[model samples]
Target: MINFINKFKGKSSMILRKSKPYRYLICILVFMTTYALLAMGLLPEKYSLEVAQVSPATIYAPRTVVDPYLTKLAEDEAVAAVPEVYNLEASITVAALSGLNQTYASLEEAAIEEDPQEQELLLQAIKENLSEEIEISHVRKFINLTSEQREYIYTNTYEILERNLSQGIKIESIDRAKNQVINELTLLTTDRDIRDLLIDINVPLVRANLLYSAEATERDRRQALNEVTEVKILKDTKIIDQGEVVTELHIRQLEALGLQETSSQDFGYYLGLALLIGIVFIIIGVYLNIYNQSILVDSHKLLLLGIIFCLTLLLSKAFSYFSAYLIPITLAPLLITILFDRNIALLLTIPLAIFSGIIVGNEFTYIILALTSGTVAVFSVRKVNQRSDLTRAGVIIAAANGLTLIALSLLTGSFQGATDFIKNISLDIIMGMVAALLSSILTIGILPFLESAFGVTTSIRLLELANPNNGALKRLLIETPGTYHHSIIVGNLAEAAAEEVGADPILARVGAYYHDIGKVSEPYYFIENQLGNENIHDSMKPLESSKIITNHAKEGVSIASKFGLPPVIIDLIQQHHGTTKIAYFYHKAKEQGEGEINESDFRYPGPKPQTKEAAIIMLADSVEAAVRSLKQPTKDKINDIISTIIEDKIQDGQLDQCDLTLADIKKIKEKFAKVLLGIFHQRIQYPQK
Candidate 1:
């Protein structure tokens, strides 16, 4: 048993060593728990219902489902309403014309024959070739007619066939069409024999041109069936009234909604829901892996993210029991934006809103409301300077929520009466406002704890530390006023440089404000705080002066720690000087004939600047002190000094640790030059002097 426990512990330790597997385990746990929570609320409730019995209680649909029987009935009605279609062949008319012309041409050929035997033979052939309705006697009479009379009969016959057959004839209209052709010929020709011959020739030629098309008819029926809208039973709609007798319709509806005792558990629904949530998780995971891999690889950040996701899901589920509109949908996004970045917050809001929608029975209006309000909350707190700013952000989120609810209400028009409509709108507004306010209130209460628990510093805390009233800054201001003033100039320079290089300006500025807190311990020992040019360092050995100067960085870390400054700010305080040699003391020691002076003894211990903000503060701190030391700090002199300081730092390899590119360095140079010029620019002498 001891060996088994040790083996399990060993395996657990191995799994935790690899961040990806650990992260995956956390994700799996979150996904399973999230699925369980959603299923608890969303799974259908089974009822023991029967026909002609009073319902024990009213039941609402857990999800939208189509009434298959009602939809089938509607589709059948739609198909029955569709008219049967027929197609005109058009070839039937052409065939009729061809047959009539052949008969007329044969008769004409026989009429042109002068030999009585040949003419009789031709008439016999034409009669045999004709339809059974056309007799040889009619053909012989047609052959016996004068050529002009024959031409007139042929023209009348052709006209009759063309007119009757061109109009589409259905199977029922064929006889009427034949009689009409016969009547037209009778009115056109007075001779009985000619009319009878033309009747026989044209009547048989008029076939039914319009034919029933089964394919077209079936296509129309299928279209009508497709057009039949399904009868959908909405979620949360009362399926049966309490104390009402259960009927066959109620039983069927219950079965359709999987609410009947006989209805088996819908594994497919559970599978579909799981797959949908899996897709949302995949989207968030893929985004983090692609654009923000550091978060995915960091155990603490990943744990925080998973916790936030699950917490939001649980809160949304719990709140949905009251009203979906009252869910604090902005909470996750607001926390994420403050803890991480805006891009992650925006992308993550999509899945969070989708989860909110699911918790509320998939209300799409709630999804829209959540996304709109969450996005507004993100932008509002993008740069939190104070705790009250969060309250202000809450007010903005409330306004966004109220506006979004009003727009959705207007679009859905779910109101039934004027008084109810007003009441519903007012309730929505109040709930939406409460939800927004609740998110803000929760964020404020939870922020400090999360910061302490996670060991992360937010912008709001940085801003607070930057306040002159803070213990560290206040001590530096009172004990080392000159250093305090110098630190302010460094902050201005650092902020401008940081902004130009796309680094966090607030962090750079705040870090600068506390970078020299150790100087407060020995205010008069520093040159800037000395009275006139009284040199305290002149009386001390060059090595001792260097030691005193280098000790401030270490002392600043201790001071900042005592003051409870963040690790990142402490890092800035420690790394501002990097490992660069203190040139003044080393040069002084060498010129004073101090034998074989070692340069390493005069250097400050450092881990270098590990981030762009740290690097900027270093440069800003150096440039501010160097430019202030120049007696004639003109524009040209300040520009030259700033460039020289940057170049020296670059050559000394102080910037090697940070990710500052050459382009960023150039922008920093320009910004430093511009700011220093503004500070050291000339002022006109007074006329009274």
Candidate 2:
């Protein structure tokens, strides 16, 4: 029972030592607090004018008076006393009116006479007699006068009679009326009174006579003297009914109230989104760390990820502000994928898009666009090798985003109002390209730090490390030439195998080169650097020898750290040996009957290979060593040895902790076999000479 308690306590202690709950909780708390602080209401209310239906006002203009001053002057008693012009003209008009009437009566009597030629002669005589007094053209024909034309002529003659009377012309009423009728003879062409009168007399003459008429002048003066009307308000302004309860102001107020009520909501929401997004970023960061097999802390990588996320949000916000119809969904995710790694980009893109939607007012259009663009970015740049590849991926993302915007615009019937939606899409494409460029710049700037800090093992970094003059490589050369040479051959073999199976060749090669760095601590003890010197293993016990060999893994880690290798490379250095027993020493201990020798002492301290590249290097290191031990150089032998080494590692469970599956190992084995065969293909089997 005591032993059981002790065991339980020990296990609990170990669990507590490894647990990261406190760190995670702290991260969450800080994020929540930060979000709460930044999400306060920051917008203002909107205002507008209100109006109801009303009738339009009508306008009026008074008729024009030709001679107001003269009429007014004439109205004065002093002015009326002055002598009036043309006093005899009225008398002549009266005699003419009488004579015209007398002629008309004579013509009527002559018309009834039996003789036709005498009647025609008498009518001609009367027309000639009226011609000099009142133009012969004004005389009417007696042959064809319709009733309507006669009535019209009568109305026109009466108007002329009234005008002459009002003007105080001294003429007999009967003669004046007869003369007026005669004056209208030319208008007998039309049957209507108004048209006939207008046809007979000129308008200017009629207007002049009306202007001079005493009655008309009196009426105009009276109208001008009337008072103007005035308007007055009856009541003070007041609010009536607040109909419908809907307006821009009301909506703005509601938004304001919402913001006030949930002051921390936006912050919390966005922060949560940011955290989720950040975690995805970190995961990608972590994976990249692993992928690159980095050995140092990389703040720049984290900063780059943050910048990419921020720029994505900024661009999305700008797009939304500039064109409410544009979708901002895929920009960040697609950009990350195209500019970085597909898997990492995909893992983070979802949250990035969600956060983007929130930043842009949780718009569905933005969500759709983000998702589409992110997917396209990931798929298009799945295996990017160059910066241009990122550009191409960005183009694809932009096109996808544009298509989404257009399609949504069309779907929602918002296309009509978007006069320059196509142009906006072009801008979005440009933005996407810009995003890619920015991402590349960010990646280049951040990769080194991330690789160093996170212990990530990227191809670029591995290539850099693989150079012979690199500090670590150079140190290895000066300290242990044989080990260095061995590492180079192992790196070549591992690189070929990794490349064949689509694993990270640079990472594998670099890892292989650095795998035996621990040998630098005790260069003379290792056979690779002995240069045909006496074997040290002969003098030391098998257990001591195994201890020395296994110590290299530990010593390698220390050296990696001293050189500022990234955590990923350090992990590879540590995990490459796993906890596998040093076989020779374990066998020697058994042969010597050392009672229960601790197998743990002969094994390497390890968490095992966690990535494909690391696992490949481990397999390559063993295969290269075993292949060099081949007695007869033959393709078959080399191939067999390589296959056995891979099979043995698998059987011994060295690859179990890594992500590499059985299928992956088989592929790896095939690659190793092929490479080994190529390297040791039999030179023309020398004819047994």
Candidate 3:
């Protein structure tokens, strides 16, 4: 496994270095394509309905979706419950009375005609004109009446029309009012023609009294449905029964939800999905540019984050086939938070949740649950100090996942009955706990592999190296006790000062511990291990001694690699003195009247400190050795020495590469002063008390 990882890592490194310029664009396009494809799978073809077609199979909600048509149907039913309105036409009755009087006058005129056929003809003409205004039967009766009788008939017909038209009547019930007018006229006069005339005139005159209020009815319906405050079809709810013949209503519900599978795919639908994916990719890219530029530019970090994202999404897609709650959504964040910082892990959380939701279905519930749970996972392990802390973090993460699941379930009101509520809640709680545990388990199992593959340093790996039983540290302790003790003091000073500067203290400390491992090869040649009068370096030429000192850094790198120590610690071994000249050896060589002494030959070959932790260790290593040489060092002396050491490093351009600020330098000096004081403080002698 280790060899395979090394080969894979080597290949990846070559490709990344070669393609550095277009790495960001490549990552974005790859992830965007993946997410778009996942969305395409979940999204249905543009919804369409075929009349009288049986559904191929039962269809369920791919995710929680609203049924707008169902909501509208409910609102329409509320509007239909309101009663119909009828409005009476007062003008109809007025016009009818005027026509009746005009008909009576014409009949009176006809009675005087001497020709009997002409008189009948004139009466018939009057009746025909009146028929347009009132009813045919009533006009005919008035036409034959004597002058005095016709007057009563006209007055009676006008009164009955007024009575019927005075009140509101539905358009459908206009005939009932006509019948009422007939009954009324019959009682007033014994003539059959009079009653029939009343029926024709009043019925024709009656208009719709109440009108249907279209606007008011719609407003009331909206108010009613707006108060309903619930989704028609919630998440995990079934849409249709298996083997049941599809109905028109079923197609309507499915079409409203955009879950209906049509015969052909929609171009517009895919276009919308591609556009949305582009937006999300833009969001991720912008965030990385603004807050995590290192990860944005470094191809290795980008690949690691992208790989984790794709892994989580693929798993979420697989688990969605079973149930939403079963997805181990928190795993990526946990792994990232442990291997990287909380900020980067938190940033990745949003995309992880979003892509997981897309792969599962278009469901926000999964996103919500994943984000909340992953936040807990990130924060819980933020300050991990021991191996047990990861497990403890797992338990807390599980509790948080379960609580978030319950809260979201309550808000959506997805429960149908007590049995359903209990069963589902239990399953959700169990699955949520499983997701958190799986995050811990997977992170624990996969962290070492990732660290080795990417050459990434995590606090867990640092803590392991800090142990006395560690291979490289143990070898130093047994082979060269003096170098081991020197390395331990360097580790303490580096860790304290790095903390003050807000750098990685564990990385600083762990790097310091392995920095002097090369001295194990020739322990007595160094003064720290030469506790007796004999000094191997005193008899040697200054040139040879300087060569021995410079060679230790190279030798340390060789030894460190042999022991399988991380690359970060080996960098400290090489960069601790940087390219600074060996001042003691150079002056001694000049005093001996040598032909020439080159400063570069005595300097350790170095790339200098490239990170804040490595830079802190370099300063701390010099300060520890110089402070220990002081004769009963006081707090004031320690402070001056630490400040002078920092100034010299600045003047020599040793601190140029690292990111430590002026403010950070002052804090590192103060920490060095405090730590040195503890080591060199005077212990007062006292008489036996």
Best by TM-score: 1
| Cα lDDT of model 2 by residue, 562-669, tens digit | 786655677778888787778877888888886778888788777677888788888878887788778776777776777787777778888887778777777877
lDDT of 1 by residue, 1-689 (tens): 97588579657755664667788788899899888877776765679899999999988887888987788889999999988897888788888888888878888888889898998898878777666765777677667878887787778778778877777889998888878877788887776766776776677778898888889999999999988899999877899999999998898889899888877657766898899889988888899989999887776688887787788888898988899878888888889999999999999888888877887887888889988998998899978878898899999999999888888888999777788678879898899999999999999988898887666799888888888999999999999999999999999999998998889999999999999999987788898888687789989889999999999999999898778788789999999889989999999999897778889999999979999988998899889999988887888888888889999999999999999999999999899989988888788888994
Instruction: Give candidate 1 misplaced runs (Cα > 4 Å).
Output: 1-18, 48-57, 62-64, 80-212, 234-238, 241-252, 261-265, 414-421, 467-489, 496-502, 517-563, 588-601, 627-643, 659-689
Candidate 3 deviant stretches above 4 angstroms: 1-15, 21-33, 40-50, 53-269, 413-421, 683-689
Model 3: per-residue lDDT, tens digit, 1-689?
Answer: 98689679768776785576668566875667565547757665443445566555667765565677676666667656654433345565567656656655675677567787887788667556445645544554555667677667667766776666666556677778767766777776676666555554445555555456667666666676677544477765676676566676677667655666652334555676677767877787898789878877777677777777777777787787888778888888887887767887887788778777777675788889888987888899988767678788889989998888888878999887888788879888898898788778877887889888777878888899898898888988988888788888989999998888888888899999998888887778787788898878788889999999888888898888778888788888888888877888888888997887788888888878888888888898889888988988888889998999889999989889889899999899888888889988988989897
TM-score of 2: 0.52
Ranking by lDDT: 1, 3, 2
Question: Which portions of model 2 miss their true places by more than 4 Å?
Answer: 1-351, 361-366, 384-392, 395-432, 446-460, 495-506, 533-544, 580-615, 643-666, 684-689
RMSD each, Å: 6.8, 22.1, 8.0
Error in Å for residue 312 of model 1? 2.4
After aligning candidate 2 to the native by TM-score, how far in Å is the CA of 4 from where it should be? 35
Show how many residue pairs clash in every candidate, following the order shown. 0, 33, 9
Greater-TM-score candidate between 2 and 3: 3
Error of 3 at 334 (Å): 1.1
Which scores better on lDDT, 1 or 2?
1
User: Each model's TM-score?
Assistant: 0.75, 0.52, 0.72
